[model samples]
Target: MTTAIDDPRRTGYAAEVVANTLLDLARAEGRQLTQMQVHKLVFIAHGFTLALLGRPLMYNTVHAWKNGPVVRRLWQHWGERGTRPIDAPLPVSAGEPDVGSDAEAMEVIRSVWNAYGGMDGVELSRLTHTRGSPWSQVYGQSADLIPNEITREYYTGLARSA
Candidate 1:
């Protein structure tokens, strides 16, 4: 049976794969991304995927952290680097789905990079923290998880307006 990762109808790559894909994209363009930047990029890519592709990008749950939307696992993976640029890719464990191989997901990721990759962490934070953003809605409330339904809805509206 095809699992979510192997299913073509979904793009539930592990957060590590998603982060590493973003890092790889940055590296190819001769730049390194900070931990915070990676967090924000992954979140943005996920949002866009939901909007454009009508599917989730990664299986990871995004939390409305104090700063912005964050995949807790991805945060911990590179959080120790603080504001410094992450110079290396996180190792993807065996049996994980490959981000590069997923054409649809890669298209979404590359588009996100083209549109938002140049923005720094603070700018990305501002984008995600804007009024009515998914993070903004759940930030001060008791809820932490930025539900996919909410995310999909918010981004769908953005897509329509754009």
Candidate 2:
């Protein structure tokens, strides 16, 4: 069956653009990127997107979990210990923010990376699962089957791409 990972809008346009931006960012910072490196970069972008949207990390975590055991372990470990945002109010804005802009979204990605030491996908996923205390509150329940499907489709795509 097709999965969210198979959706071009999700895994192709949005995810790929973010991944490329991250790769460029890492290179600008003098970091070398491997295939897995690209994978991690994309993962971080996905996580940052969720955080900025005020959405739970469920989908992102599930995506990471499908990547590999390393990802799953990362989620399990970091999701348990991550820090959370304290209740606070945002200043009233005159209009809705442009959530679809890449430049704006990239800022959030950079912020998350800076706050977490620019960890790779595997490490970041692990950290998020373990150290992202706020995330845990939202990730109270696990969705086992969904993640498996996501992971399967992702790997299958990778294989086809290879």
Candidate 3:
């Protein structure tokens, strides 16, 4: 199986691009996202994409931060806890503003949202904080990027069992 690293469009998404879309998606669903929720959702969406599609939904790296997995670029936009609009080019390969129009991407995003959207930031944080989770494996490694392989494997197992 080809990994995102081997794909030409692996870098198709800018973190800001996904962050903006996710924030909008949350709002459209009447769920306003805090910085933490947005971060976890992105992580969850990425993991599902890797598990099911065998490709990254977005190009951004997930960082092991104090709370959980985070996209640094998204954090920069949201600040410490505030959710606000940050301009970014859409993630579509064609550079359109409708990044959510990609059916496969939307399917994963909505699936993740439905599974987690009702939860608070702290609950999502706990989910990532599980002892064997990718974030747990790198908890104190300040500069580590949570490996995609770990997330893919973990979520794949989850998908299979569910």
- Candidate topping lDDT: 1
Q: Which candidate is the best by TM-score?
A: 1
Q: Mind sharing the TM-score for model 1?
A: 0.93
Per-prediction TM-score, please?
A: 0.93, 0.42, 0.80
Against the true structure, candidate 2 reaches a TM-score of: 0.42
Could you tell me the lDDT of residue 33 within candidate 1?
91
**lDDT of each prediction vs. the true structure?**
0.88, 0.41, 0.74
lDDT of 2 at 126: 60
Could you tell me the lDDT of residue 3 within candidate 2? 77
> What lDDT score goes with residue 88 in model 3?
40
The sequence of per-residue lDDT tens digits that candidate 3 reaches over residues 6-117 is 5434544566556667777777776566778778888888888889988777777888988889887776655665444234422333542344556777788788878887
Those runs of model 1 whose alpha carbons end farther than 4 Å from true positions after fitting are 1-11
Worst 10 residues of 3 by lDDT: 84-93
User: Which digits, one per residue and each the tens of the lDDT, describe model 2 over residues 8-127?
Assistant: 334323333344455556667776444444445445444444434333222333332333222342333234332332122222224322223545465666765565435554565464
Worst 10 residues of 2 by lDDT: 84-93
Stretches of model 3 off by over 4 angstroms after superposition: 1-12, 82-98
